[model samples]
Target: MRTAVGIDLGGTELRAALVAEDGRLLARRSTRTDAAGGPEAVLAQMTGLVADLDLAGARPVAVGVGAPGPLDAEAGVVTGPPTLAGWHGFPLRERLAAALGLSVAIDNDGHAAALGEWRFGAAIGRRHFVYVTVSTGIGGGVVCDGRLLRGRGGLAGHVGHMIVTDDDVVCSCGNRGCWEAVASGTAFGRQARRAAAADPAGRIAALAGTAPADARHVGTAAREGDPAALALVAEEARRLGAGIVGLIHLYSPEVVVIGGGLSALFDLFAPVIADAVATRAMPAFRDVAVVPAALGPDAGLVGAAALVLAPN
Candidate 1:
């Protein structure tokens, strides 16, 4: 069976896999990203991980890597990515090809993720949809007419930068009051910490040893009927919904897929987000079905591999 290698490069770690054309995982490997050493080191680490997977006889055709951005997809370079500190203007595709000695493709993580779903996951039958994942940060990919929309310089569905909350939360993009700043995992941790510090009696506050009472912890507490924790989650769900509603109005996707670590509590937040959208979004936009991301962290890996195998 002919195969391809896919790599998902994030700020914290790098993952790669050998995959079948039909979306089966043949092999996989992972390594920590060298963000501290800058882009050169990060790229080198990615190269090493792919090598370790060793797709010897599978007829590896191409490589696809999904990275955090602002990226110049046309140029195969990452431009001033805020999530990856000190790695500015990284020539991703060039570096990987030189190191691995293989033809390579690169894309913003969101765009890569969208492609993964359309090709291998839930969006396979859907022609128009958006895959939005809220992880350490927020990101999304737009698919219209069965093509992933790579808006100028790979910054199209940067809905995380949308200013939904009035709070002055600073975004890595050097902006205040951005949606990511208020609605992502980073935001959840930040808010949970503040709430914990202020309310010593609250579940999040009383629960020591947990890191910053993040979205996960808060969600857990709310599930157990903790009022203070419920409040935190409710606020986050509201902001998340507001941002999503904006995407709905703009893209009119047939479905909106929400993934990422934060999505562990999709059951807790989904209804709240849907309610917010119902009340806030225009009636026409309100019909867009909101759903959980079909692919997990594996979505990026599967998607990246798919890119190499299919190469549109």
Candidate 2:
């Protein structure tokens, strides 16, 4: 029962967990990420967290980190992560290794989550698969041949930045008409708010207690049977399913697991995404089963800790 530490870094806080080789979460905790002080300060706090966990005598092989993307995993450097300001060109893996005196591996957060799910979650017993999480942005990861398929530089799963439609919306990635701009949780929520504002009958307005402005509100309204909210959700499902179609064409996975707060409405969206995939994806790709992520909110930490147990 060896253990390793897995860190999930984000714009607001950093979550670390001690995970056993078999996917049990032995210990888990979190700390706020100070955006003003930048990556160095965050790194310091992260190291302190690992120290607090008392891993000084642990036998885990390595530390696995799930970080915001656009990173240079091989070089251990963060080229530029837009969500976290001043993280440009930061030596993430090297800095953590030096701070913890342990080998460190860094990955795009989505890829890490996908790896986590594959190793120990619903993705178990599956071969080719795709993972999509819609939070601050729509993040994705690919698993092929029972291994994570991060592309060169590990930015391969930047599905949010993919241009699915030629709509006029702009993505944070600075690309016009990117999928994130149109169908991400951010976008889903934004659209719901707009509709609610224009039409007081929209359910998201009441659910948010005042015309909410994030996908969570929309999903809640959809669950409650709001017409406007349901339409928005339908759009989200189609958009998300379209993305799944692309992955199916590329990897031909046995299953597609989707998670994140927004995915709570999987019952409402799965059919739409499934319908879209069937309509658009090739026949061979059509048979893939699309399902909800087995692990809930803590998938990243669970999967990350498992990274330490990977045999060399």
Candidate 3:
């Protein structure tokens, strides 16, 4: 089977994989990102990981990368994603291509994930859809009329940054009331931590103990039928659903696929999201399906590979 190299470069971790033509991940390796070590260190780490995947014996024809955004996909340059400090204006595609001695393609992680789903996952056969990853912060990709919607500078599908509410919480993008600011996994954790501090005897507090709490603690408490945890999750789902409703109104997509770290709790969030859309979305767009991503955590990796395996 023909194969390619795919990389998912994130703020905390760097993952590399060998993906077959059919989207199966044949081999994979990952390491914690050396953000403190700067771009050169990260590049060396990434190259070493790719070399290790090469030993798996599938001569990859090309390489594809899904990197954090504010990037110029057309120019193959990374223009300073907040999470990836020191990557401003770096020619990622060209550097990787030269190092690997092969063709290389790169795009925003959200766009890559969307392409993966469109080509090999849940959004298959759908001409209109949106893929949203709700993790540390929200990120998204859109497929319109069977094509990835890459707006000017490849910044089109930044649905997370969309102003979804009236709130004081500032998003990493230095904005107030962004969907990500209110509904992302980071936001959920922050809220949980505050709630736990206020209610020392509550179930959420008991689950979190003294350590920093995140969305996972909330999920655990919710599963145990804790009322506060359940309420927090419900509110998060509502916020996420509210943003998704906007996407439906704007893009008229057939389905909205949810992925990322929080997707592990998709079963918990799905019903609430459905209700938000049903009640708030315009009557004409309420029929859109909101579902979990089919590829789960592998979506980014497979989607990155799709960049090289199947170009726009």
Candidate 4:
């Protein structure tokens, strides 16, 4: 079977995989991203990972990378994604190609995830769909009429930056009231921390341990039936639902697939999200399915591989 090298580059982690054309992951490795060490260090880490995979003898046809963006996909350059410091205008494609001696493709992580799902996961056979990842931050990708919708500057699916509130929560994008600012895992953690500080008796304080409160703690607390944590999760669901409504209005996708680390809480949030979308969306859009991504954390890596196996 023909194979390809796939890399999912995130702010904190780097995942590399050898993926067959049939969407099977043959071998994979993951490690911490040397993001604080700057772009050169990140490149070295990626190169090493790819080299390890290459030694498996698959002889990949090309290398595909799914990375945090604000990127120039056409030029194969990263254009200052907030999560990845020191990567502005970095020639990621060129560097990878030079290091691996193979053709390379790059895209926004969200877009890659969407493509991955469309090709291999939840959105399979769906002509129009959206993939949203609600992790430390939120990001999204849209597929319209069976093609990935990469806007004029390859920045089309930045749904997280869509303003959702009038509150003063600032986003890493330097904006206030973005959906990410108020509803992402980071936002949920921030709210949990404040709640814990305000009410020392709350479950969040106990669950937080030595580290600061985060979305995981909130989810754990909710699962354990902590009222405060349950409330927080509900609020996040509402916010996320509101955003899904907006996406439905804009793209009219047949389904909206939610992924990322926070998606583990989908069972807790899906009902509220479904209700919000059902009630608030236009009558015509009320039936749109809101579902968890089937590919899980592998979506980006598989989607990155699709860049080489299926370019659309």
Q: Write the per-residue lDDT of candidate 1 for residues 91-110, one digit (tens) a residue.
A: 88898898888899888888
lDDT of each: 0.82, 0.80, 0.90, 0.91
* Residue-level lDDT for 182 in candidate 2: 80
Model 3 lDDT at residue 85? 84
Model 2 global lDDT (CA atoms, 0 to 1):
0.80
Q: Which one is best on TM-score?
A: 3
Clashes of each: 0, 2, 0, 0
Those runs of model 2 whose alpha carbons end farther than 4 Å from true positions after fitting are: 54-58
- Candidate 2 lDDT over 135-253, as tens digits, reads 77888788788777767876787877878887888898988888788877777777877877887655666666753556777777777777787888888888888878887887788
- Residue 43 CA displacement from its true place in model 1, Å: 2.4
lDDT of 4 by residue, 217-299 (tens): 88899999999999999998999999999999999999999999889999999999999988999999999999999999999
Give one digit per residue, the lDDT tens place, for model 3 in 1-312: 888888999899899999988998998999999989888898899899998874465689899999999789999999889998889999998988888898899999999999888888999889899999999989989999878999898888998999987878899999999999998989988999988988989988887788877788889999999999999999988888889999999999999999999999999998999998999998999889999999998899999999999756
Pick out the ten consecutive residues of candidate 2 with the lowest summed lDDT. 303-312
Candidate 3: where are CA atoms >4 Å away? 54-56
Model 3: residue 309 alpha-carbon error in angstroms: 0.7
